[model samples]
Target: MIQNNLEKYTIQLPKKLNFVLKKIDSNSNGIVFITNLENKLIGSLSDGDIRRGMMKNQVTKYVNINSKYINKKPFFLNYNSDVKKILSYLESKKNKKKYKCIPLVDNKKVIQDISTIESLRKYPIINLKIDNSEINNVIDAMKSGWISSAGSFVSQFEENFSKYLGGGYSITTTSGTTALELALKSLQIGLGDEVILPNLSFAASINSIINVGAKPVVVDVNPKTWTIDCNRILEKISSKTKAIMPVHIYGQPCEMDKIKKIAKSKNIYIVEDAAEALGATYKNAKIGLHGDCSCFSFYANKTITTGEGGMVVFKKKKYFKLANQIKNHGMSRKKFYFHETVGSNYRMTNIQAAIGISQLKKIKSLILSRRRIFQYYNKRLRKFNYINLLPENNWSTNSYWLYTILIKNLGTKKREKLIKNLLKKGIETRPAFYPFNSMNIYKKYCSGSYKFSEKIANNSISLPSTSISHYDQDLIIDILIKEINKLI
Candidate 1:
């Protein structure tokens, strides 16, 4: 929640000058909003305003603030107003240093929340999950003067990560994309091979396939799960099909049992893109165990972070060895600096792995926090018929990575408008990743019907989740309800 920044600070009217003085002095940015009986914003008072008013009244800090002290017409922006105009207005006020934080209000003059550069800096779309432990480890690693790929922490991270994902062996890589690239290369899937994947995923999934020179076969996703339709995957397989890359989108695991069965029968390899689904499970078993190789991301926003790292977890020691060689310039294990085949330098650094180890220790708590946040949002969002929140189906446990939702009857443009409205209130949000077929750069790689994926992409919104203030989430939901009612 980034609690130290005082994001929810507010002052009530009829408050005395003593309190106002203390508040303005103690507030994070030397300012406070003055609200009326209904919590409706009436004005604001700054530290300078308090001092000047005290001088004019010839009174101590005991006098009431509303008695000719408050700026009753303090600058504010409507929730649905253009964000550029609000920021421009704030920029103009910044020179005075009078309005470091601006209040955003609804038409009813209720202060939804205050927007401050400091508070905004404190919290972001997906706040970095690092803490003091990770920081200390990073510092210690630097002191040891071993910040490169070849350090003890890298091996430790891989071993611990493999154990965490259920007794598998793991190889660390520079990024999630390379993890997928290494996994595919280990499977010997390239050029003449085809890999089927859902369209409702980040471009990294498709890019990995293309980088390995394997043709990407796109399939539609189930609207409910927002994952590849298991029924659709089997139909996409051809004699050239070598593997299936099922993405665990937005923390929800795909129908792995069904996909695994089909892949097993066809002798096709399975590569699970569990990048966003760390700590999630399918039927009480962790997802990484279901595929031949499961790839995870440690991007800053993921459930855990290594700043910029990824992992390839596999059940077989042989597959781990293959991935290791592929990422290490295809060098033979017995020969020093001897290359056996073509490969890439995709090794993850010890510094990143050090952070990953610290972050991983808190993965359970982090995932639980996200799920609790989802529960908080779901209880409120479900009352609205027009909104549909993501579900934790019986077959899988969701990590609630993004806590996304779909707005009924709202196309891409209106959903965009909705996002803009939220942004105007300084609440960050994101749209669903567009279907691969819809993205022009990847269009040539995708040739399939993606009606459901396209629809979900257009109508969905990834709400503010992660470690966030419930008070802030309440404000966000309130503002959302208000703006959505306007649209209706």
Candidate 2:
């Protein structure tokens, strides 16, 4: 119950049925606990119990602790019960349909708190770990009244982020989608141009290419890396191919050496959609350093968040300057209100940057925590023959933004049923991204059979990773194993 105030939910015995009814009405959960003079919990009452009591006693005016309607055998837990104990009780088959809230009682049977289903059963796929540092920075930004796109924190965040990636020109944007769009626009790769990328990625990747008036050339991902098949890039290339976007899916870095070699020989640009792979590396270099330009997201679910924001890192100053101009409505930097080129409002706010600055300070620790979680999941689930763990190639370090697994031989329907059953048990799971060509708008971009991409999308499930406690992880693993066992 997270140690909340329990006064509103507790009441003494010698009370009228109407009084108990009012107490239940006052509380949001529609429940009230009846206690004795020593504050010892005796029973509980709900709206349904009161209605039944009214009919049984012919609308009795008064009720006591011993009333027939008082539920003496109410489900409860010890006041000092840990999270695992609470979750286990809630997930028990006996309590599934009967109880939505449980009373926390001490050894003496004195009620201490109330735990609701919403409180005890919540297991989010991702949760932010914000501290006082982030709060103070945001408050400082607000007090300074430079809350918009103009402020010192914006530049500080850019500088810190660039330095983190081993030095590159960086510009902030409204979102990762905007960062990708700006990257494409900065390179002058638009109409009559084509960009090749893997079929398995967030919709933003393909949408960014289409938004820039470029045809997205979709290709199959490798079965092991779950990244773009560098071996297939050559056959998909043409004179119109301006760039090759290799997405680091699930924070697993693509085989950049091969992709870079191909791009060099073909004289094609490389724009990386690194939104999911920040802090990850291909070989020893960070993810954003391999391509001509790379985009990263700072959305809420990302390793580091700014509420909603993104960054673009460029390999050259020319592209950086051009992208900066396009980000702020294409206004000339030297003159006020002077329009240099057609652009959109893609600038990130100072307040968001302030939060980003605080998050960036702990980026290393955050990445380590995610990696540890991945290792734990791998160790526990490896013995099961029905699932394949996330890929961590020898040449790459996966940040493991999400602990995803592929269920062997499971079709889409059975996999969805597994997800649904887990969700019903209060454990959240995410299906892998659908192949780009599967969508109606991208059907025309289908070039060949993306069998591997489709198979991954159909069978993969991303488990909860961020800020999850060891107890929560155990609960999820237990329930997941049980449910998967049922399916097979």
Candidate with maximal TM-score: 2
Pairs with steric clashes in candidate 2? none
What are the models' TM-scores?
Answer: 0.78, 0.82
User: Could you give candidate 2's per-residue lDDT for residues 64-175 as a string of tens digits?
Assistant: 8667887887778875576666756666654454556788777778886676766554456875678889999999999999999999999999999999999889999999
TM-score of 2: 0.82
Compose the digit string of candidate 1's lDDT tens values, residues 1-488: 22333333577856566776677777667788877778788777777776787688754545444367667788876644444444555666534434577776766788765666533322246756555899899998898888898888999999899788778889999999899999999888999999999999999999999999999999999987889999998888899999999999998899888998999999999999999999889999987889888999988888888888899998788888888887999999999799887888999998999999899888888888888888899988999998987756788888778888888878888888988877666567889998898878888767668888888888888877866656657766888889877775
**Runs in model 1 with CA error above 4 Å?**
1-123
List residue ranges in candidate 2 displaced over 4 A. 1-82, 85-120
Q: How well does model 2 score by local distance difference test?
A: 0.87
Count backbone overlaps in model 1.
1
